[model samples]
Target chain A: MLRLILKDILIQKKTLLTAFIYGFFAIYVFGVKYYTNGGFVAGAVAIGYLFITYAVSYDDKNNCHIALNSLPVKRIEVVLAKYLSVVLFGCIGIFTMIIDGFLAELFGFAMPKNYVAINNVLMVFGVLLVMYSIYYPLYFRFGAVKMNIVNVFLFMTIIVLPKALGEFILNHENNPLIKEVLNFIRNSPKSVIQILSFAAVALISLISIGTSTRIYKSKDF
Target chain B: MSNILEIRNLRKQYDKFSLKDISFSLERGYIMGFIGPNGAGKSTTIKLIMNLIKRDSGEIKVFGLDNIKNEKEIKEKIGFVYDENYFYEHLSILEMKRIIAPFYKHWDDGTFKKYIKDFNLPPSRKIKDLSKGMKMKFSLALALSHRAELIIMDEPTSGLDPVFRIEMLEILQSLIQDERVSVFFSTHITTDLEKIADYITFINDGSIVFSRPKDDILESFALIKGGKELLDKDTRKEFLAIKENSFGFEALTDNTDRIKKIFKNEVIIERPTLEDIMVYTVRGEIKCLDSY
Candidate 1:
């Protein structure tokens, strides 16, 4: 199974190269403009998510599921192998970004505080966990073709809702105490809160994996 | 008696077409040709037996074990080749072997090496760089090198040229010498099956139209060509299909011996080829005539 997973990754070497190039350009632009450690972490997390999404979508498009099913391996092993590949790539992307971040800092670029950097890393991972939690099951049920459209809609909702709510909360002029509390929450200890958020995200990811696996076992493929 | 594979009442339904109750068994050391037209549920039945697709209702036994319950064990001994090449296009054949070698317990590097030499495959070239015949030969080499007991192929020879097709059939013929290896290959090329298969299973409209020994089918069915006067309504019922022109008529019949006795000197009896039987069976045009 490990060998199969590695072969799949190797097969998509061109896609990986494209992803890496895009990541480099995107991160370099962010580093030049924003020049914050938090931005690096955010960039790394985004790239990781993009990698997972591309890998899953490619496999779905090529009917790799059918090919894999024809092999001697069990269905469960196939699923687990996919998840492991995502994790493996995620770690590699994160590590590469960390090095890139440090190099920028060494070259006299402005950087965020260490606490902010740490918090950004945690938040990025949190977002990825949430995104994968929702998307994996959707992909499993509806397939990549349909899920791509659904994903666009879901992404729009996620981005739009938070801004709308934030504006709504801020416009309430009569609630001075609520404003103060919200401000404090926003400015709280970056590391501790980030850790808590990541823990929650990890827990949610586990639940999603369990749910996806159950659905997959019952699936006709 | 230790049949390599057995399928009982296998059924799967789709919106377009459904596989009716289909059943067949392949004994050890024999090649079974699964002959069918396009959309005849040949591939679907293979998928169900391999557990790539789930059956709506049926029992599949491979190597004397339940296919689904003991799929891993069953798969371990079976090697499969799809109609098209499914390997990663960017990887070289050698890279693919490295990746797949660990999956099978009996993978023999020496045997794999021998196949590479026999097939004359360039290990360093990526799969996409190879021709269709080369790609298929590579797939065959992989399927055979793992000490597999059963090889299941879906139209493995459909796209190859005549030379490669014959070569592939020859390799399969040699593989069955041990009496432990069995092959179930589906193909539209009846001539290839005629040359290699010991048993033949004909599928039409998602149903098994005929399944019997190749020799038996050849011996039992025949073609009769005679003059237009032979085309009486009564005799037409006995033929599977018939073509009539101004001068004469040629009919295909399953009961060759009986028909020979009935038409003694009026018609000429000749051996019917597998292709003739397939065409006649599919068109339902067999007819009999009284004129010579």
Candidate 2:
């Protein structure tokens, strides 16, 4: 299983160089423009998550699933390895951003402070776990080809939803249901909000892992 | 338990085709050639045995254990080679082997190194750089180094040159000396099987036509060639298929004894090769008009 995860990383080693360059640029821009975006490391997390797509694309590029199924590993174990690889890529992303930030600071470029940097990495890591919990199952269920189509819709929604939601919130302040939900999130104690977010994401991720494993078990090569 | 692989009523259903009560067994230490034309369910049957695809009905046992229930254990002891390359195209041969080497407990690094040297495969060259035959050599090296008890190859020789095919067959033939390893090789090319396969399992239209020792199949089936006048209903019943042209007609028959009784000293009765049997079964001969 460790070898499987390592294989995913090894194949994408060259991409790590590009990721580092991108991380450095993002961190530099975020530091100069926002100064503090509360866990600006999320920026790097987004870049790192893209590599997971590269890993899966590798699998699809040659129909590796057939070769993988031929191995002695169980189908569930194969799913578990994929989930673990996603986390591994997340770590690689975080590491890349931090290393680039340090290098930039030494060269006298502005960068996020260490404490904020750590906080941002952890925050993005959590976000990744939640997002992948949804994404991995889709990859297993639809496979690489169909998932690319799904990815287009998903990315489009991500690009469009924020502005749309902001407008909806502003226009619907008079609506009782919208007002109540907004009040709950805005007025909740920090600890209560944290606990709710953690619990919801954790629950979803667990379900995602379970679903992915089930889908892979009977998947035809 | 004497057999390394067994399938009993193993069936899979697709919208257009379904395997019907397929059954065959390959004893330990012999190669069984799985012969069929395109879409004859040869690869489908192999896929079911590997549990790559689920079977709609029937049972498959590998090394005396249920193929699905003992999938990991069975796969540990089995090495599979697909028709085309399945490993990552960008990674070098060594990197690909690294990914597979750890899964099998009995994997031998020394043996693998030996094969890489013997096959002259550069460890650093990416899989995409290698020729089709070279890729197959890499596959075989991986399959062999793991102490596999059975090697299941699906059309491994289909696209390779004859020279490499013969070399590959030599490697398979060498493995048979172990007396514990078996090979289940499927191919449309019967000549490849004729050279090395001890047993032959013929499948057509998603069903088993016959499974017997290679020698027995040759002995049982014969080709009869004579004029079109020998086309009575009783005489035609003995033929699996009959082909006719300007030079009289030729027919295939498994009932060599029965046909001999009817066409004795009149028609040429000659031994049929695996190709002849395969072609006769797949391409039924052109029928003669019912001219009594």
Candidate 1 residue spans exceeding 4 A from truth: A14-27, A115-122, A149-203, A214-221, B285-292
lDDT of 2 by residue, B5-51 (tens): 99999888899999999999999999999998889999999999988
lDDT for each residue of candidate 2 in A135-196, tens digit (9 for 90 to 100): 88889988878888776566445435656999999999999999998899899997887788
Per-residue lDDT of candidate 1, residues B109-153 (tens digit) = 999999899889999999889998898888888888889999999
TM-score of chain B of each: 0.95, 0.95
DockQ computed for model 2 against the true two-chain complex using alpha carbons: 0.78
The DockQ-based CAPRI class assigned to model 1 is acceptable
Candidate 1 Cα lDDT to native:
0.79
The per-model DockQ list reads: 0.47, 0.78
Model 2 bad stretches (over 4 Å): A113-119, A152-189, B285-292
Error of 1 at A153 (Å): 6.3
